[model samples]
Target chain A: MDNIAGTKSSLTWAVHISVAALVFLWLFPTLGLFVSSFRTADQIATGGWWKSMFPSQQNLTLRASPASEQKLEGSLYVIEGELFEEGIEVEISRWGASSQNISTYAAGEVGEFRSGETVTVQANGSYRIESETEISGSRGKRIFVTAITPPEFTFENYQNVLFDESNREGMAKAFFNTLTVTIPATVLPILIAAFAAYALAWMDFPGRSLLIAAVVALLVVPLQLALIPLLSLHNDITTFLNGLLGLEGANELKGKGYVGVWFAHIGFGLPLAIYLLRNYMVGLPRDIIENARVDGATDFQIFVKIILPLSFPALASFAIFQFLWTWNDLLVSLVFLIDSTGETTVMTKQIVELLGTRGGNWEILATSAFVSIAVPLLVFFAMQRYLVRGLLAGSVK
Target chain B: MHPAFLGLFTILVGVSVCVGYYYFSNQLLDKVLFPAKGPNAGRNINRREMIRPWLFLMPAIFALGLYLAYPVVKTLLLSLSERLPGGASQFVGFDNYTKLFADEKFWEALQNNMLWLLVVPAACTAFGLLIAQLTDRISWGSIAKSLIFMPMAISFVGAAVIWKLVYDARPIDQDQIGVLNALYLLFGGQEPQTWLTIPLANSFFLMLVLIWIQTGFAMVILSAALRGIPEETIEAAIVDGANPFQVFFKIKMPQIAGTIVVVWTTITIVVLKVFDIVFAMTNGQWQTQVLANYMYFQLFTAGDWGVGSASAMIIMLLVTPILVWNVYNARKEMR
Candidate 1:
C-alpha cells in the first residue's frame, strides 16, 4: 500500500508536467490577442499588456495656458492647475524644447529656449513661461509632461467591430453568410449520404462494391482539380435544364449564390458522405436489418423504419463532422460562389478583408474572430458526443 | 467502353426507374409494408431479388463516373496541353510538368505542402495524444476534450482569423498592434516582422493553424480508439507488473497503432488538400502557398487550365499510395 501510494504520486507528477506543457502550447497566442485587443493602438505598439501591469513613464506634451493667461499674483507669473490625471503619480521629469527631444529640464530650474525665452514646469500642472517680449502666434505654449497609467481594458474594440454599420464587411454579416452556406452544405450532404448509404449498405447491388471503390478512389482526388470544370459543368447543366424547361437565359441561376455553392458542395461532398455513411451503415447488425426484411418491409420502409432509426448515432456523428467541415470550408465557396459584386461573401472572406484593412488591430481581430467562432463552438459542443457514443445502440449496447 | 457513356446510360435508366418506382414502389411498399398506407406505399407486388442490386447500384455507379471518372480523365488530358486564353487549349506534352519542376514558386508551393503534410499530421497526432492521455485520467476529461475540440467546429477560415491576429504585424513606426509583435517589443525587438511575410518560418506558422484545427479531429478519432481498448487487457498487464508507462507504451500504444496510422493518414491526406487557409489568408504570397492553392492560381487566376490539370494529376498521383493504404486498412478493419 505504501509503495503504491509513492508510485502513484510520481506518476501524477509526470502527467501534470505534460498537461502543463500542452496547455501552454495550446494557449499563449489567443491570450495575447485577448490582452492586445484591450490596449490602445499606441500601447500595443510600445509594450505588451503583461508589461503594462508595472508603472511605466510616458512623455505627454501639452501647451501651457497662453502667456496672456499667466496670472500675475506677486512679482512673477504663476499658473496653477493639475498635472496628468487625478490619482496618477508623477515626478516632474526634465522639460524639452520639442516633443521629440523632451528631456532638457531639471525640477525648479528654468530652461532657455530659442529667441531668449525661458520656461519652468513643476510637479503640479503649475508652470511659467517668460520672454523678454510677449509670446505670440497661433501656436500655444508647449509643456512637457509625464504620467503613470494603470492597466486599462475596454469592450470598445468589440463595439467597433459589431455595431459599426459602415463596416459592410463586419464579421456578423459574414457569420450569417457562413451559416447560410454551412447549414445547407452540411445538411444536404447528410441527407443525400444517408439515402445513398442505406441503398449501398442494405439494398442488394451488383456494382455496389465497384461504386464504393469508385467513391473510395474519389476520396483521393484533390478538390482543387474540380473547381473550374465543376463550375462550368454546373453552368452547363443549369442552362441545359433551364433551356429544356423553357426558362431560357437564366444565366443568373448558375454563378455565386447559395444555390451554386450548395450544389458544388453536394457534388464535391457526395463521394465522402456516401463513403463515410456506408462505412457506418455496413457495421449495423445484419439481424436487425434482416428481421425488418423478414417482416415484409420494402427497401424504403426498412430505410425509414429500422435503418434510419438505428442509424441515428452515425447520422448524428456524421452530421457533426460534416457541419463543422463545411462550416469552415472556404475553397469550395470561393470558386463556386464568388461573384463580381461580393454580395454573397461569407465569414472567411470577410475576415480576410478585415485582415487587409484593420490588420494591425488585434482587438478588432480577436473580437471579430471570437464572434466568428461562436457558432462552430456551439455546434461542436452540442454534437461532439456523436464522435464517441456507441452507434450500435442495443445491437451491441 | 468509356465510363462517361456508361455513366450516362446508367443515369438515364436509373432516373427512369426511380420515376417508375415513384409509382411502382407505392404498390410494392403497400404490399410489403403498409398493405395500403400512402401514395408512396402499397402492398403485394412481385420483384425479383436480382433486379434490386442493379437498381441500387445505378445512382451510386453513374454519379461516381461523371463526377469522378470523367473529370479525372479530362484533368490528365489537360496536363498534356497548353491552356490558351478564350478557353482554347493546344497540345504541349510535359510542358506544365517541366514548368512546375523548374519554377521557383511551384517548388516553394510543393515544399510548403510537403511541410504541411509532415508537420501537421505528426504534430496533430502528438498534441492529440497528449490531450487525450491527459484528459482521459482527469475528472473533467470530457470538458477538456470538448474545449480542445472547439476549434474543430470553427471553420479553418475562422480559426485562421484568430491566428492572424496573433501573427499580425504593423509598420515599425506604428505601435505594435498585433499580439506577437507586442510580446516581441516587451523584450525589445526593432523590426515589426510581418510573421506571415517571413518566407520559410511562415510555413510552420501556417502549419500551426492546421494543427489547431486538426488536433481535435485527431483527438476525436484517437480518443475513440483509446476507448476501444479493452480494460481487461490493461488490467491484466498491470497485474503482470507492468508500470503505467509500460502499460501505456507497451500495451495501449500497440493496440491503437492502426488507429494512429488511420488518423495520421487521414489528416495527411486532408493536409495535402489544404487550400482554404492559404487561399484565404495569404493568397499564396510570401511563400505561404500549397499545391491546392497553386492549382487554383494556375487554373482560375492565371487561366492555365492544362497546367492546373497537370498539377491536379500530380496531387492525385502523390495521394494514390496513401489512399490505397487507407482502403486496405479500412477493409481490414471492416473484417
Candidate 2:
C-alpha cells in the first residue's frame, strides 16, 4: 500500500503543513494575549505583540548628569555619565539634543548643543558633555535618543492588577469572590445531580424516559428568561421572611450575594450535569449493581458505596464542566450576585469594568484577563482527559 | 464574615445537607414507612421500590423547577404584564409585544442574530471538517487538534480582550499596533480602518471569535466520526479509481452527514445565545446588537421588564424548535 503511490508522500506533507498552519492560526490570538500580559504599557502601545520578541527601536527622552556632577577638566566644565540605568540592555543607535531632530547624529558621534556644549554619545548610552564656559543650570540637559532596546517584559502589570492595595480596580477581591462563587456552585450541582442521575439510570419509576427527555430539553433553555422573575422572586421571599422572623440583616443576606448565586448556578448547571451523568451511569455494567442488591444493600448504600465510586470518570467530567462554567459566568453573577455595594464582583465583571474605564490600558486589561483565564486553563490542561471524555459523551450521542 | 471562610462553611453545609438528606430519607422509607420484616413484607418492599425513585429525584426536581421550569412560565407571564413598584404587577396583554415589535433596536438585533446564526455555524463546521479531514491522516494530528481545542477553555470576555488586540487600530501616520491594521498597512492600504467600527463587517469580525473557539469542538466530534467511517468503504472507493476529492464528497462525507448536522445545530444554539462577546467587545453599538444584549439593555439599563421579558420570550421562541428537535431525537434514540 505504501509503494502503490509515491504521491502519498506529498499528500502526507500537505497534511502536515496544513495542520501546522491551522494550529498557528488558532494559537495566535491566545499567544498575543499571553505575550502582551508581560509587556509594559509603553511597549504594548508602540508596537504589536508579535514584534515584542525582538529588540524594539524607540525614541526615548533621558536626562544627562546635572550641573552638580560637572567637573572642571582643563578650561572647560564637563559632565560624563551613562544615559541609561545600569544593567539595562540598550543600544543608542541615534542621538540628538533637540526634539525636532531626535536622530540628528549616529551612535558614537558628537554634536554641538544649542548651549554650545559639545556632546558625544556612544552605542552603550555613555555620554560626555563639555561646555566651553561655566555650566550654571540647575537642571540636567535633556537628550533624546533613538535606541534599540532588547525585548523587555515586566511583572508590573500583574502586580498592579493583583496586589496593588490602593488601586480600586484591583482583581484581588474579585478573584476571591469568583472563588467563593465557583466552589459551591460547582460542588452543589454535582452533589444534587448525581442522585437524580442514578434514579434515572438504575432505579425504576414511571416516566423515567420522560424525565430524561426533560433534562435534555432543559439543556438549551436560555438563562435570559430566568433573570427578572428570579430576581423579583428572590427579593420578595427575602423581604417576607425578614418581616416574618423580625430579623435585621435577612435582606442583606438574601440580596445578590454568594448564597443566591450558588443556588442560581446549581439550578442552571443541573440539566447538563444530570444529562451527562445519567448517560454515563446507564452505560455502567448492571452486574455490579445487581450483586450489591443481592447482598441486601439498600439503594442508597449501593449508590454511595458502589455507583458513586465507579462513576468517577463521569463525575469528574461534570465537575470540570460545572467548575469552568461557574467560574467563567458573568451574566449570572451580574444578575444574581453583584449588589450595589459591588463587593461581590467577580473577575469577569472586573475585566468588563476595566474594558469600559481603561479601554486603552492593555497592560491592565491583558493582565486582568490572563488572571481570570489562568485558573480555568490550568484545570483544563491538567484534566484534559476527563474534559475531552466529557465533551465526547455530552455531545456525540 | 470573610468570604473565604463563608465559602468553606457553605461547601460543608451544602455537602452535608445533600448527603444527609439522601441517607436519612432512604433510612426513613425503609426502616419506618415500609419495614421489610412485617407480615406483609413482600408488598412493603414492592411499595418501597416505587417510592424510592421520587425520594432520590426530589432535590433535583425542586431545583430544576424553581430555577429553570418556573422561570420559563413566569417569563411568559411577565411578558404579558407590566411590573409596578412595590412587588405588584398589572396585566397588560400584548402591550409589551407591540412595543417590542415597533422598536428599531429589536429589529437590528434580530437581523444581526440571523446573520450570526448563518455565519458562525457554517464557518465553524466547514473549518472543523477541513481540519478534521486534514489531521485524520497525519502523525501529529492529536497535538494540532489539542492546540485548536485550547480556546474552548477561554472565557468569552478573555477572548474579547485577546481579539481586541488583534482588531486594534491606530490613526494614520502612526505605527499600527493591531495585527489586522498592521497587515492592512503592509499590504498597501491607504488609511488605518477601525475594524470594529465598520457596521456590517464588524459583526462578522466578532463572529470570527466564536468561530475560532468552536471549530475545535466541531473538529473533535467530526474527526471521531471520520475515523468511524469503516476502512473497507474508503479502500473500496480508492480501488474503484475515485480520486481523493470524489472519495471525500461522494463517499466519506455522506456517511458523516448526521454528525455534521449535529455539530451545526449545537453551534447554532451557541450562536443564538451569544452575548458576552458582543457585550464586552462592542456592547451592541454601531448596529451590532443581538437579542441577548438587547434584552440585557432593556431589562437592566432601560428598566423595562415587560419588553425585556418579551425579548427573552423571543429567544425562547427561537430555541423551541431546537428543543423539540433534541427531545424528538432523544425519544427516537430511546425507542
Candidate 3:
C-alpha cells in the first residue's frame, strides 16, 4: 500500500521522525524510573538519570590515611595511602586542602596545609603527606577532589527492597500478598464466566438476549458504588458466621481477607469475562455444535470437550486481561483485603506508603515500583497479541 | 498460613468446586430428576433443557447480582439516608446532596472532573490517531507501537511514581534530578518549580500521566480501524491527485470517525473514574482534588458515608450516558 504505483511517498521521512518522537516521548518517563532503580542514592541525588549513562564529574571529599600510621622515612614523617577505596576508577583533575577552595591546585601538584605539611595528590587518588616534624593528629587529612568517575550502577537497592528481612519497608511480604490476591482473582473468574458465557452464547433459553444486555450494562458500572455496600455486607456476614459457629470472642473470621477479595474480584471481573467469551463463542462455527448435538452429546459434554478447546484463544485473551487487571489493581485490594493491622498490604499500597514516608528517596521508590510493575510488563510483552485481539473483539463492533 | 500456600489451596478448592457444581447439577438434571429411561422421557428432556442453562448461569448471576446490581441500589439508599447510632438509619432525603452541593471541594472536584473529561479523552484520541497514522506504513512500526503501548501495562500507582520522579523539583542551587526541572532551568527559568504544587496547571500535569498511559489504547484500536480501510479507496484517492494530508483528512478520516468516537468515549470513562494517580501523587491536595479521590477522602478519611455515597452516585450519574450508549449499541448490533 505504501509503495503503490512504484513511487514512494514523499512524507516517509516525516512519518518516521514523528513516530520516533512519539515513541521517545512515551518511553522516557518509564525509562527514567527503570534507570533510576539501578542507581545508588548519591548518584540519583547528584544528577539526572540521563546523566548516569556517561562519566560524570563530581566534587568528592575523601580522606587519606591518618597520622597514626605515619612512618619516619629518611627524616620525614610521612602519612601515605590512597585517598579512595581500591578498584574505584576515578581521575582527579584538581585537588585542594580546604572545602572553601576545593579546586585550588591541579592534580599531582603539591599543596601545603595550614600547619605547613605538604601533600602531593595524583589523578588516581593516591596521596603522600610529609612533614619534618611528627604528624600528631588522630584523624586523616581531608582531600577534596574534582574527580571524573565512570558510569556506575548497582543491584543493592533491589536487594534491600526485595530480600533484606530486617528492612521494615521491604516489598517481599507485599509481593507475596499481591500474588496471593492476584492468582485466585484471575483464575476463578474465568471458570465461572466460561460456563455462564457458554450458556449465554449457545443455550436457547428465554431472556438470553436480555441477560446479555444486562451483562453489557454491568460492564461499565463503576465498582466505586460497590465499596460501601459490599464492605458492610462482608462485615455483616462475618459477624453472623462467627456467631453461628460459636467463635464470636475468638474472632476467627474477619471481613477483610484473601477469600473476600477473591470473591470481590470474581464478581467485578465476570462481566467483562462473560462479555468477551460470549462474543467469541457466538462466532464459533454453527455446524460443529449442531453435529455434536446430533451425536447425542449433552451440552455440558459439548462445552467441555469441544467448545472449551475451540475457545482457547478467547479464554487466553480474557485470562490475560483479568490477570493484568487483578495484578495491577489497588482499590479493590485496599477496600476488601487490607485491614487495620496492615499485614496483608499489597505492593501498590506499600509503594504509596513509601511515597509519603520516603518521598525524596528515589532509589527505594523506583525499585519498589518496578518490582510491582515488572510482572505485568512481562506478561504484556509476551502475550500482547492476544491482548490486542481481545480488545478489538471486546470493544469494537 | 503462608499466603502463597493459601493461594494455591484456594485455586484448587475453587476450581474443583465450580467444576463439581457444573458436573453434578447437569447429572442431576439429566439422570436423576429427568432420566432418559423414564416413561415420560420427552417431557423430562424438555424440563432438563429448561433448567440446565440456569444451572450453568447460577454462579455468575449470583455474583453479578450481589456484587454489582445490589450495590447500586444500596449505595443509592445509603446516600439518601443518614446513619444513626447502633446500626440504624434515618431517611434524610436529599440532605446529603444539598450538603454536597454547598461544599466548595465538591464543586472543585466536579470542575476538575469536567476539565479531565474534556482534556484526557481529547488528548488521548488525538495522539492515538496521530501515532496510528504515522506508524501505519513504517517497517519498525509494530515495535514502536508496542513501546508506546507499554505504559498501559503499568499500574496507576507505578505510573504515579514514575511521573512523580519526572516532576520532582529541588532547590535552585543544586543539580536537578528531574528531567522537567532540568529542562526548565536549562531554558533560563530562574527557579525550579514544584510542578505538582501549582494549582490548575498541576491538574493538567496529572492528566498528562493518564494521557500517557491511555494513548496506546487509542492507538491500537484506531490503528486497526485504519488498517481496515480499503486500500483501493486510498489508491483511488491517490490516483485522483490527493496529497498525503489531503488524502488522510478527506478520504481516511471520514471512514474511521466512528472508531475515533469509540476510543474517545472509552477513554472518557477511564478519566472519569481515575483515582490512583491523584491518590498516590498529591492525595488531592493543592486544589488538585478530583471526584473519585475526593469520594475516597470523604468515605475513608472523613468517615462520612453519606457524603461518600453521594459522591459515588455522582460518578455513576456521569457514567450513565455511556452505559446507556454501550448497551444500546450492543442491542442494535444484535438486531
Residue B30 in candidate 1, Cα distance off native in Å? 6.5
Per-residue lDDT of candidate 3, residues B142-261 (tens digit): 999999999999999999999999999999989999999999999998999999999999999999999999999999999999999999999898888777888889999999998987
After the best TM-score superposition of candidate 3, give how far the Cα of residue B213 lies from its true spot, in angstroms: 0.7
Residue-level lDDT of model 2, residues A1-397, one tens digit each, is 5422223644777788878989998998889889999999888887888888888788899999889999998998999999888998898888898888888999888887888898999999999999878876889899999998888889998888888988677699999999999999999999899999999999988999999999999999999999998988888888787778787853344756788899999999999999999999999999999998999999998999998999999999999999988888889999999988788899999999999999999888999999999999999889988988888888825
* Candidate 2 residue-wise lDDT at A311: 95
Docking class of 1: acceptable
In the range A225-344, model 3's lDDT, one tens digit per residue, is 999999999999998888889785546799899989999999999999999999999999999999999999999999999999999999999999999888889999999999999989
After best superposition, candidate 1 residue A160: deviation in angstroms? 3.8
Q: What C-alpha lDDT, on a 0 to 100 scale, does residue B208 get in candidate 3?
A: 98
DockQ, cand. 1: 0.29
Q: Please identify which of the two predictions, 1 or 2, would achieve the higher TM-score against the true structure.
A: 2
Q: Which candidate achieves the best TM-score against the true structure?
A: 3
**Could you give the CAPRI-style class of model 2?**
medium
- How do all the candidates rank in terms of TM-score, highest first? 3, 2, 1
Q: Model 1 — TM-score against the truth?
A: 0.79
Runs in model 3 deviating more than 4 A are: A1-6
Tens-place lDDT per residue, model 1, A1-397, is 4224123445566666666666565665556655766666666666655566566666677776555565555565444455456665566656675666577776667766564567777755466676645556555567665644456667776677777778654666666667667666666556556667877787765666655656676777777667666676777877777777777453435545666776666567677667767777888899987887888776766776777787787777767666766766778877787677776677677776777787666566666766776666777666667755522120110
lDDT score for candidate 1 against the true structure? 0.69
